[model samples]
Target: MSSANLDQLHRSTLGVYESLLDQFNPGLQRLVALGKTYIQAFQALSSTSEEYFHALGRMGEQALHTLSSRSLGDVIIQIAESQRRLTNELDGMFRWFHSEVLREMENNVKLDKDFIAGSRRRYEMEVHNHASALDRQQRRGHQDVVEYTHFLRDSQKDALKEEERRYRFLAEKHCNLSLTIAQLMNKMGGALHQRAEEWGDCVNETRASRPRTPSRMEQMGMREEERAQQWTKREEPSLGRVPSRGPSPVLMRSRSGSLGDGLGGGRLMRAIVSCAPSPNPTLLDFSMGDAITVLVPEPRNGWLYGKGQNSPRQGWFPASYVEPLDQAPRPPLPRGTNPFATVKLKPTVTNDRSGPRAPGRII
Candidate 1:
């Protein structure tokens, strides 16, 4: 009977659970007392339940003795057999109850692990499996991004190489055209000189033959000299066209060198925006904390070309507002080189965010 009653620990747990049940209820203040009454009733039932089991066993024993020397011996044998079977069944019920309920109550964890779903241990295994799957998913996503970045970088490099090839071809074609024009101009000038000399000889023969028209001959000569001078002046600027229009090293490398650097290149060197660039259309717009990918490391007129990591636009911005992410921040662009010197913000003081912060005490 005492075994049927819950132990101290279980009774304490029951009381705690009963208190929890009445915690949020709005109906009554006497709910806690009602729960206590129910617990007390359960505890009191142990004696009554024990008496009932014992009474049933005594009744069966008395019945067997009285019926042993009955009007029929066959009826006595049947009663004894039923009693044995009832005892066995009762014993099995007791063993099952003891193992499943009474022994289970002795442990801190009410339910021992059956290794199936619903056990704490199994739940932990499931959680670990889920966590592993999540980690793999995250790693795979990162790998995909890295691969895509490499692919894009290679593609850009190929495109840049193709552009350089085309530029060289165009420069060579331009040189050929300039050379051909120069040759044609020289040939035309030679032909004009030959014609002028032949015409002068003919005019001299005409002047010697017509002695009365010397003044007319002089006027014709003066007009020819004036015309020749005017034509020479017209051809002078065109004479230096071949060398000037040919390919220059500066123009050739403008496309190739700016965007394409080394293995340690544009992607690694980032332009983190320390300050927001001014609102100018030529300048790329970005806020502080935005990162820019440096496409061109070389500064031109205090400007840099970069594609924004946080944005889609790419253009030149003043070098004053950005600093390297991986490297130590270099001083602002030189005063002579920095065209935005006047507009550039000067930092008078610096504070690391790691510095101790003061709690405001406002009046």
Candidate 2:
């Protein structure tokens, strides 16, 4: 009875495990699908960003081109205008200083004249009463003149100091403005250089990674005929004529069918692989120069579902990897050969290891 209960419990546990797995599988597939979608979206965004940068670079180049076409006279005119403005500002400052100095000197001279006149009047009025008053007035007048001369000298010195301070301030301001302009120009130059370098690198990388497109002749059909002829010549030295001797059975069979039929039918199409793919359940791993069949002509998220012609296995591959055969010229088949032939399979050997070997017989 205990053994029976254990068996029942074991069966129940297995049922639960199976139920959990059934629920998880659909969710897992959804997650994988979402991941693939995200990858494709990210790739598109990256390509768009690259194109935007390219456009910005082109605009910068165009601006430089326009600047190159401008005349040197225009630059000279701009410099002249700036110099004229500076000169006008300096002239205004000097004029203000000159007017201030003139006004101050006039006031000082007027005060001196009034004081001298009052002393002369007093000396004249007291001449009869006191003869020494005349001498004293003369001495006072001399002292006042000396003091006025000293005051004038001091005023001139102060004016000179003020002028020096104003000139120093202007010089310092001009120097600072010049330094700021130089820094700004340097930054602009550096930024332009960096952007140009990035654009150049991007262009080089794009050229290296992108496959070269076939020329007009190759695309139109002339090149395909030539390639087909070359392939035929390489494969068959004799141009469809019966050999002098009896031809072998293999030779009797047309070899033209081995090469793919022309890309006429919608059901059949050929492509040359340009890029390799990583291992994925939906995608096939293919290398460069490999030929593949397009099961679906249109792409889904930049990926195409296809089968390798040589491999004959179906899977998804990047659309960019293969060029469609419809664009190229199709080759005509030689006369008297089936366009489609059955692929031959090698006979399989049966191993009888399951049965006991008789003595003296090789196993």
Candidate 3:
């Protein structure tokens, strides 16, 4: 199944073949030597005379006759037949050795080729699967980037609309202030006219009662002198009560000025104060990619905190038991404030009487 397993099988098979060769080698060597001796003997016999051959046979017969064992002739014939069959089998074994070894080697070669082919096929299939997966991931990543960019653009447009609304509110407040001042001025003018008419009536009543002791000119002079002094006090517009216009765009913009330092001072969208151990506290940790989360003291299965904050509460924690989770890459920050920072918390309500069931106050 595996390349390593296949290799071990091949090694084992080869070891067996080597061991068999070792065992058969000595027998093969002995057979080769015996055959060589027999060939030499035959060559000498071919050159020998007919008388010598007859004498050799008589000598063999005399030797056999001298043996006292019964059936010596039969025994000699049996021994000769046995030698012939042994020699023939030995020769057959030698001849087939070449064919057998060749066939075995061919089978081993075929096995090796098959193992290599299977391994190559498996490797190729794995590579193809990996490539397809990578392509899909790339496509998904591209889509996410496009969606994020669109979201940022929409946020920017919303911010611009909010700024426009603020300016419009300031203009309306200014107009209302102007109308209130006009109304106050009209009321003051009517009061002044009524006072003047009352003075004229008093002068006519005095003239009708008696010949005017002080002339009209004298009365007019006194009135003019008094009026001049009073006018000085009322010279400046009394529009302080008539509300000055609300802060103009210029003044509002000044109040919300840019940061003096290089680092901007806009509200943080998210401020995660990670109390993780520093590599070298004396030096700055420049690893911006690192992120951290606050680890609430609890079990892994979210059982300690209950379902919500309704349970008896504990304060927020820092990054004590937490590890950083890798975040996807993000773009650079744009210049703007987060409106959420402007939200105010509701005032806390407290009961006068102290009891076990007293409500929690949101201080």
Estimate, for each residue in 4-55, the C-alpha lDDT of model 1 and write its tens digit. 2213323443343233233322112243345445445644554455555565
Stretches off by above 4 angstroms in model 3 are 1-62, 65-70, 93-98, 114-122, 125-131, 134-363
Cα lDDT, model 2, residue 204: 62
Weakest 10 consecutive residues of candidate 2 by summed lDDT: 239-248
lDDT of 3 by residue, 316-349 (tens): 2221112234433433322232323345999998
Better of 1 and 2 by TM-score: 2
Candidate with top TM-score is 2
Question: Cα RMSD (Å) per model?
Answer: 53.9, 37.2, 61.2
Overall lDDT per candidate, in order of appearance: 0.46, 0.47, 0.39
Off by over 4 Å in 1: 1-146, 212-363
A best-first ranking of the candidates according to their lDDT comes to 2, 1, 3
How do the predictions measure up, each by TM-score? 0.19, 0.22, 0.19
What C-alpha lDDT does candidate 2 achieve relative to the native structure?
0.47
